[model samples]
Target: MKRTVRNLLALTLVLAAGAAAKADEVLLQSAKSGLYVTVVNGTLAASAQDARQAVKLDTVRLEGNKIAFRDVRSGTYVRAGVGQGTMLATGSPHIRSWETFELDRTGRGEVALRSSQNGLYVRAGVGRGSHLAAVSERARDWETFRLVDVRNAGGHQDRPRPGQGNGNGNHNAGQGPDLSSLIGNYRITHVTADNGFLVPLGRELAGRARMSIEGRGNLSATAGCNSISARIAVENGRFQTRSQPMSTKMGCVIRGQSLVENRISQILTEARTVQRDGRIVTLRARNGAELLKLRRM
Candidate 1:
C-alpha cells in the first residue's frame, strides 16, 4: 500500500497539484491585533487592512528545510538578529545568514514563521513603534498569522482593467471623458521619484503642493518652492509633456518642500499614462510604473 501511494504521488497530475499549492501571495495577519503583517519603514509592523502590505513566502531558497518571506514594496528580506529581533533589510553579507524562515501551518490557513537564525518564532509587537519580534519558539497565539489573499482584502486601489484606452476601455468606441474635465486642483499622494523607490507624499508636502491640469493642455502646478507651468499632450489616455516643466526661481526656507517640488515636476515630464477614478487620478510610465497618484482637492 505504501508503494502504491508513493507511485500515485509521483504521477504528473499529482505533481501539478502540489505545485499549485506551493506558490501563492498571502498577507500575514496577526492573531493578536487582527492587523496584517507588513514591512513599513524597514521594520515589520501590523498594518490596518492595507493590501499593499502583503508579502510573499518564497517556496524556493530553502534554508535548512525552511523558506523566506520577502517584502513586495522594498524587495528586501525579512530577517532577524540575536537581539535586534525581526527587521526588513536588504540581503547583504551581514544579514545573508539570517534571511530564511521555517513556515509552520495551522488550522484554517493560519501559519507561524520561525526564524532560521535563532530558532525563534516571529511575534507581533503591538502599539506605537512596535515591530515584529522574534521570541522563543513555542505554542503561542501571538506568533500565528492568517494567510489572506490580497484579492480578497479591501482598502487598496484596484488594478486597471485590461484595456488599451483611458484605463477603463473608454477607447473601445473612441468615447471617453473630456480632457477639460480634468482641469482642477489635485493633491499629490504618491510619487515614484526614481527607479525602484516609491515615496508616499509626506503630510507636509501633500497639503502644500497641488497640481492643476489646465483644459488647453497647459499645466499650472504649485510645489511649495516655486510655481511651475508646462504644456502637456493627451490622446487616447496616453499622456506626455514636452521638455521639463519650467519653474519660477523662488528660494524657500523649507528645503524639503523644494525637493518635493522638483520630484513632482520630474514625474510629470515623464508621464506616459493617465487613469482617473472619481476624484483620484493616477499617472504611470510607458512601462506602467506608477509615477504619481493625485486626488482632486
Candidate 2:
C-alpha cells in the first residue's frame, strides 16, 4: 500500500505545476571518460523530428548505480556488452554494467542491466557525422565524464561493439575518504576562469552566504540574497548541482543586486570537491582553481 501511494505521489508531482514539493525530478547523466556524454531526457511531448532535429525535453532523471527511478520513463540508458548479435541475454557481464543513455532515437532506450545484457541504447536527435562513441567497458569510480554543450553537439545512432575491454566498472563503496569529513555548508568566495564552468545562476550572485551539505548527497543554501535550493549529486567524492530549484526574490538593487546574482551563479558553477583535514572540510573545484570554505550551517 505504501509503495503504491509513493508511486502515485511521484507521478502526481511530475503532473502538477506549482511551488515544487521537493527536488523530485532527477536527471541521471553519464560521465564520458574523456568527452562529455549527452543524455536523452525522455520521449518528447510533441512530434519527433528527423535524425537531427531539436527535441524539447521536459523532466530528466539520473540513471546511475545504487539509485533508480522506478516511476520515471522506462528508457534510461544502462551499460551492456556489445555482442555479435543485437539481443542481450540474462546473467551476462553487460548485465551488471551501468552507463547513461546517449541522444539517439533508433530505439536506444534506457532499461535495467539487472535484466538484460544488450549494449547501451541512444535516442537520435541532432548529431551529425558518425562518431564511434561506445561504452564497451563499464564505468569505474572517479571516472570523469563531460557534458558537450557545444552547438548541435548531441544526437546520433550508436552501433554495437563486439569485443571490448574487460567489463569491471569502477567501484568506490569502501575506498577513498570518509563521507562525514566533507559534510558542511561552505561559502564560495571566488572562482577561476580555468574552472571550465558555465555560471548556472548569475555572476552578480555574491556576498555573505551559507551552503549546508549532508553526507547523503543533499545540499541547501541561503544566497545571502535569498533562499536557494539544489540537489547535490556526489560521485567519486565530488558534487555537482542538480535541479538547483531556487526561491530567490528578484528584488535587489545596485550592490545588493550584484550580491544576489554573483552568489547564485558561483554556488551553481562551483562544483565542489572537498579535501579533508580533520574537522575542517576544504572544498575545492575539480581543477583546484577555485576553493570554498563550508561550515555547519
Candidate 3:
C-alpha cells in the first residue's frame, strides 16, 4: 500500500509540472488592433489573423519579475531596439537586457510588455505598418495585448467581441473612439498649474487659446502667442506627444500671455489622459491633475 501511494504522488507531481509548462506558451495579440504579434521575414509585426498563424512564444520567467519571450519554432528571442530605434525584432539566441520584458497585467486579463533595456512599454504600431515597437512611455491601449494560450488556441480569435471592453478602458473592443470624435477644433476653456508648476490663468485667454487635432496624429495649438505643432498618439482615452512640439518664436506682447503659452506647450506634451463628456474634453496628467479643459467647436 505504501509503494502504490508513492507512485501516485509522483504521478501527480509530474502532471502539475506539465501543466505549469504548458501555461507559459501563448500567442500575444494586440489589444488595440486585434492583431497577433508574428514574425514576418524575421521582423516582429502584429498582423496575423488568428492564433494558428501567430508565432508561439514561450514565456520564460526570470528574477525581478522580468520575463523573456522565445519563439518556439525559430528558437530565437524577441529583442527591443536600442537607443532611438523603437522597433522590435526577433533573432537573438540568448536572453539579454533587450530581450527581457516585464509583463504589466491589467485586471481584465490583458497585459503590456515593458522592455528592460529602454524602460519603455511595447506598443503595437498599427498606424505605422502594424509593427511591434517598444517606444511608448505609458502602457495604454496600443501597449496592451491579450495572451492566448497555445494549448487552447485552436481556431481562437483574439479580437474581442462587440460590446466587450478590450481591457484598455475602450468599450468598443479593440478599437478606440473614432477619430471624428476628437479630430476637430477646440477652444481652451480652462487651464491650471499643478504639481508646483505655476501658470497664471486669467480670463483674457479664454477664447484666445485654440487647438486643432488633424488626421495622422497632427496637432496644432495656440495659447494667445506662439503656435505649437506636434505629432500625437491617441488610444484608450489617453494621448501622448511624440516629442517636443515646434513653436513659432513669437514674443508675446500681451501681459501674462507668454506664461500661458509656455504652460500650454507643457500641458500638450505632458497630458496623458483625455476625457470627453459631451462637447467638453478635459485633459489631465497621469496623477489625475487637470491640465487643460476645452470645448469642442
Candidate 4:
C-alpha cells in the first residue's frame, strides 16, 4: 500500500491534496506585532480570507508587481490574493528560488516548463517549486490559495525568536485590517533630505524610495538609493513602520556625509498614516503634517 501511494505521488504535480494536511511542521508563534517577512517569489499562495495575522507576510524586495520573498519562514503563514509572472521564458527552464515556495517537507519542488507557454508565467506559491517542468503552460494564470506551513526547507527558522526584537513566548498578534485598500505602490518623490535640511545635495538617489501593499494587512517598501528596507503594519486600521534595519549610507557627495542619514531619520519620523481621500492616498505624519501623496499607476 505504501509503495502504491509512493508511486501515485508523481513529481509532475504542483501541490498534492494531502500535502498541507500531512506535511511535517512545527507550530510558529509570531514575535512582533506583524510578521516581518519577504516574498521569495512574486507569486503568493493563500486567499483573501486567510490573510490574517496568523498568516500574514511582507515583501521588501520588489519592483512593480515582479517580486518574490527572500524565504518563507517555517510555519510562517500568509493569506493573499496575489499574482505571478515568469521572469524567464527559456534557458534551462529556470525557476528562481524566491519565485517559488512551499509548506511540505517531503514534497519535491521544481520549475517545469510546458509547450505553448511564453513570457514570465506567474502562479500560486503553494506548490510553486514542484511540477515546474510540466505544469507551466497548463496551470491557471492566477489562483488564490488558502493554506499555511513553511515546509522543511532546511533554512526555515524553527519559530520566531523570543524577546530579541519584541519576540516573546506569545506573538504580539493583532487582528489586522484589510490592507488591500491601503495596499498599492507609493512613488517616493523625495529621496529624504540632507543634514537636518530638505533636498539632497549630492548625486540623486539611484533607486527612489517606494512603498507597496503586497496583500491586505501588509506593507513593504524600499528607500535610500535602494540601500534601506521598509516594512509596515496595518493592525486595527493603525499603521506602523518598522525600524529600518539597513542604515542609511555614508560618505556623501559634498552635501555632508550625514545628509542621507538625516533625511532617512526625518522621513522615518515624519511618516505616518496611510490616509486616502477620493483616489488620493496620502501618507502623513501626525495630524496632517507634510504627507506624500500617491495614486494608482
Candidate 5:
C-alpha cells in the first residue's frame, strides 16, 4: 500500500511538471499573414518563417484572465505604445498597464490580443514592415493569432550558438549573411510580380533606377521619380527596414515613374531575404515572391 501511494505521488508530480512547462512558453503566429511574431532590434515584428526563428515568449498569467508576453530573447515585456502612438515595442522590464493584454480566444482555434492600457486590439501590419501595433478598434483578421504551445508542439529549441549551424545547411549561425559584402551601388535591372510577369518600366526611368547601400545600415534608392532612404537590419536570415522610409517630395514627370517609385518602396519595405549570386542580387518577400533584381554597378 505504501509503494502504491508513492507511485501515485510520482505520477502527480510528473503531470504537474508537464503542465508548468506547457504554460510558460508560446509562439504567437498571426492569422492574417501566417507569420510568427518576432523581435527585431527591440521592436515587435511578425515575419518569422518557423518556430526556430520565432521569438519565444513567456506567458505570464494575471489575476483577471489577462496575460503578458515576455520576450525571452530580450528579457523584456511587450509594451503597447501610449496615446497617439500605436507601435508595440519590447522594452519594459516589468509588468505595467501597457505590458498587460487580454487574450480573447476565437471559436476557430485562434486568439486576439487586446491591450489593457488602451483597450485596443493588436494588429500585424503586414506591408508596413510587418510591425505589430495596438491601434485596431476591433479584432479583425489582422488582429487574430494562434498561440502555439512550445512544449506540446515540440517547437522549442536552444538557440544556435554564434558558430554553429541550425541544421538547415546555413553556416551563418543564424545571424544572417554578412552585410559588408552587399555594400555598393546596384542598378535596378528587372522588376517582377509574384506571378513571374515582368513589370514594364518607363524607358527613361528604367535607365536611371538605382540603389545604394551605405555603411551603418543606411539604404537609399531612386526609381527615377523620388529618392527614398531608410535604415535596414538583417536578423536571422531576414531583411528588415523601417516602416516609414523618408522620401523626397519631388513630383514625377516621367511616365510610370510614380508607379515604379511606389513599387520599389513597397519591395524594399517588404523584403524578407537577400540573395546574391556574383554580380546579381535579389530581394524577396516573406511569401517567397521576387520583388526586385539588381546588378552591381
Candidate 6:
C-alpha cells in the first residue's frame, strides 16, 4: 500500500509542470557534464550527478531576469566577490549586494548564468571534477547549464555533512565525474535481452555497429545495414528515447540486420539505468536487468 501511494505521488509530480511552482529546488545541470551546481566547503562548483544538500540551493527570489540563490542548509547566499573566480556563500546581511545573477536562455532546456556584479558568465570547467568559475564573457558550451526538474529526479540524494567522510570510500564522488563523457563514439559489444540473456553480435553486426550521442541529445547509430537516429534524454545516468528513432527504410540485406535493428531499437527505447566503469558503459532496464553494453571507441 505504501509503495503504491508513493508511485502514485511520483506519477502526479511527473504529470504536473516540470519545475516546482516555486522553483525552489530546481537543479542547474552543466550542459557539458550534466552535473548540477553545488557548493563545496564555501566555493561554488558543479559536481553532483544526484540531488543532494550541496546541490540543493534555494532560489530565494527572482526579479525580472536577475535571480538570487541561497544555500538551503547553510542559509548563506551565493555571492560573487571581487577578483574571486569562484563564488561563495556568505551570511552577510546584504543578500542582493553580490548574489544577483542574470539568467539568459540559450536554447531549449539550457540557460547561461551571468553574474550581475562582474558581468561574467558561469563556466562549468573542463574535464572531470572541474570546479565552476565565473570568468567567461561568452556563453559557451561550458557556460550553459540545463535546468533539470528535481521532481523528476526522485528528490535529492542525501549528502555527507561537513567533517564526515563522503560516506563511500570514493573520494571523487564529491567531484562530479563527466557523465557526458559518454558522448563519443562507441562500438556495441553485446546486447542483453529483456529476459537477461546476452546475445553476442558476432561478425555480421559486431564491428559494423556504431553509436554516437551528440551533446544536444541527438543519437546516431549504424547497425549492419540499418542507419538509426533518434532524440534521447540522458539524465542522472539514465536515458530514455524521447521519440521513435528514424531509420533507413531499406530492407535488411544481411541475415542478422533485421534482428539487430529490432533489438537496437528496443534497447534504445527501453534503456533506463546507465552504468559506466571506465571505458565500458552498460545500459540496463528498469528492473535492473542489463539491456546493452558498449565500449568506448
Winner by TM-score:
1
- The Cα local distance difference test for each model comes to 0.59, 0.34, 0.68, 0.33, 0.68, 0.63
Model 1, 66-117: lDDT tens digits are: 6655444334445665234444332222223366667788676778878766
Which sections of candidate 2 miss by over 4 Å? 1-179, 185-207, 245-247, 253-267, 270-272
In angstroms, how far off is 244's CA in candidate 5?
32
- Residue ranges of candidate 1 with Cα displaced over 4 Å: 1-27, 32-58, 70-109, 114-140, 148-181, 188-207, 216-220, 228-250, 266-295
User: How displaced is residue 60 in candidate 3, in Å?
Assistant: 0.3
TM-score of 6: 0.43
Residue-level lDDT tens digits of model 5 in 132-224: 889889999999999888666455444643422121112233555557778899988777543333354556776989999877779888977
* Model 2, span 16-66: residue lDDT tens: 312323233332223322222221111111111111222111222323222
lDDT of 3 by residue, 210-237 (tens): 8899878788888778898888877867
Count clashing residue pairs per candidate.
0, 36, 0, 27, 0, 1
Worst 10 residues of 5 by lDDT: 163-172
- TM-score of candidate 5 against the unseen true structure: 0.47
Shift in Å, residue 31, candidate 1: 3.9
Model 6: per-residue Cα lDDT at residue 252 = 78
Better of 2 and 4 by lDDT: 2
TM-score of each prediction: 0.48, 0.31, 0.44, 0.29, 0.47, 0.43
